[model samples]
Target: MAGNPQGHQEGAAGAARPVGVLALQGDFREHVSVLRGLGAEVVTVRRPEEAAAISGLVIPGGESSVMDKLSRAFGVAEALKRRIAEGMPVYGTCAGLIMLADRIVDGIRGQESLGGLDVAVRRNAFGGQTESFEAELSVPVLGDPPMHAIFIRAPVVAELGPGATALATLDDGTVVAVEQGNLLGTSFHPEMTADYRFHQYFLQKVAGFDNGTARSSRP
Candidate 1:
């Protein structure tokens, strides 16, 4: 079943693209707010059918295991796999990052993932909520001035496959963000903050340009 982008109730004039947030469970509203603030049409995607019409998808931070089960139950998992296979742009944060990872270490038994990024992530590598912390990262792709990253029981990309490119890292060199093809994954919550550069970069880099064409990769 194809998605209904027209079903969206909130939109901005000259919206670059309709971006869907997997609304099954998570901090989805925060993502929606950020996308809308960036002048993009926002849709809350619950069923697999809703995954079709959007130009890109955002999987927000939540319980990776629960999100996985919900995605499968709603049939959005298969639909998402198809769209991503067709080169649809996707940005995942926290648990969303876990969903896009090819492999996850210490994941719950039978916990499944959508899998696109060629990287291995260890769930809650940053420890529990008591261990949650924040740091300033120099993400050159988003320009200087350092991006503030918040970690809440966040996972860390333990290793990258040949195709993965590290975008941000801890001062000690731990990978926190990465990109592969049309997909972007981050271990931090960009939506929870006021900065919109990461989302804008996703639009410019992964979701294609305003003219509806993929942007040429930065040299």
Candidate 2:
């Protein structure tokens, strides 16, 4: 269920702008809660118009194929792609990371993605739900204490293109988080933990983009 579309929150240059969370499916409510707690007006985006109203968006962890179908059926997929092309900041977590990848290694038949981040992702790279685990990742970009990440049937970046930079990796050197321009992606559920650094980092990207200080990474 989408949240009410009316509210004012301080953002870039002290301007008010809403941060949207794709609410067609998944743990969107968690993302919404985190963003709202961060003092930003949050919008639960369902329809295309809702997608258009936000300065930045967060695609939550959900079933990637189902999310893809619902977003297209609801007519928000194209709108989001357009916004990404226009340099709007976006943060994608877990399945959301798969949706933002340029290539999917093991997507279900006919499955599609929004395709913004320049990387190839292998769905279910860590196996089934029972294989889900937690890890403390050292993300230099975030600094200080390591980020505690939860992976639930998560994807992994198989091939990170030159356009994107790896933000965090596992002890085995497997890429789990990436960033490109105004876009950020992680194969773990940041919203599930107490740490809000990923969300805060994403908000900074949103602020920069909204202030016209962010350079578009799209080619």
Candidate 3:
């Protein structure tokens, strides 16, 4: 959808165009709740047609391998890759971050990622779910007081290529958040917390893309 001069895209009835949550597998409902709370129309995407309709998409935290398998099985994987290549804004969290990485350092045998962000991610970099923890990260893009991030079975960016920029990292220097043009990924679950800045930041990218002002860094 072409965005209006104000950078808000609207549908036939003049409602804002929906932002999609990849619902094949993940904590998608939490994302939907957050997006709606931010005043954006949200749609749960499980099929190719749904994937094609959204101005932006959020891939939520879950089992990355499972999400990969289901997206391919449901024929939405290819559609999503195409959309990413076409400059659609996407925000991926935790397992969702793994799916968007170009190189998966520890993916299961035969596992595949949609591949857009130019980075290598190590699955479960912080051990297992029991090892999950929270940290206050310094994300200059978000600015001010650090973001309280919750990491659960999160993947860490092992190698960020020239095409991507690190947005936030732990004090120990582990990369936790990244941005590449219209694509954003985090090694934590923002939906699991009260902070909505990341979601709001992503919507701005969506608006930019819809208005034909977003730059694409697909690899």
**How does each model score on lDDT?**
0.82, 0.88, 0.89
Q: Which pairs, if any, clash in model 3?
A: none
Per-residue lDDT value at 41 in model 1: 75
Stretches of candidate 2 above 4 Å error?
A: 1-15
lDDT of 2 by residue, 1-219 (tens): 112222334444676668899998899999999988887788899898887778888999999999999999999999999988988889999989988998999899999999989999999998999999999999999897999999999999999999999999999999999999989999999999999888888888777766676657586
Regions more than 4 Å wrong, model 3: 1-7, 10-16
Clashing pairs in 1: none
Whose TM-score is higher: candidate 2's or candidate 3's?
3
**For candidate 3, lDDT tens digit of each residue in 89-111?**
89999999999999999899999
lDDT score of model 2? 0.88
Alpha-carbon shift of residue 196 in model 2 (angstroms): 0.7
Tally clashing residue pairs in candidate 1: 0
Model 1, 60-118: lDDT tens digits are 99999999999999999999998778677788999999999989988999999999898
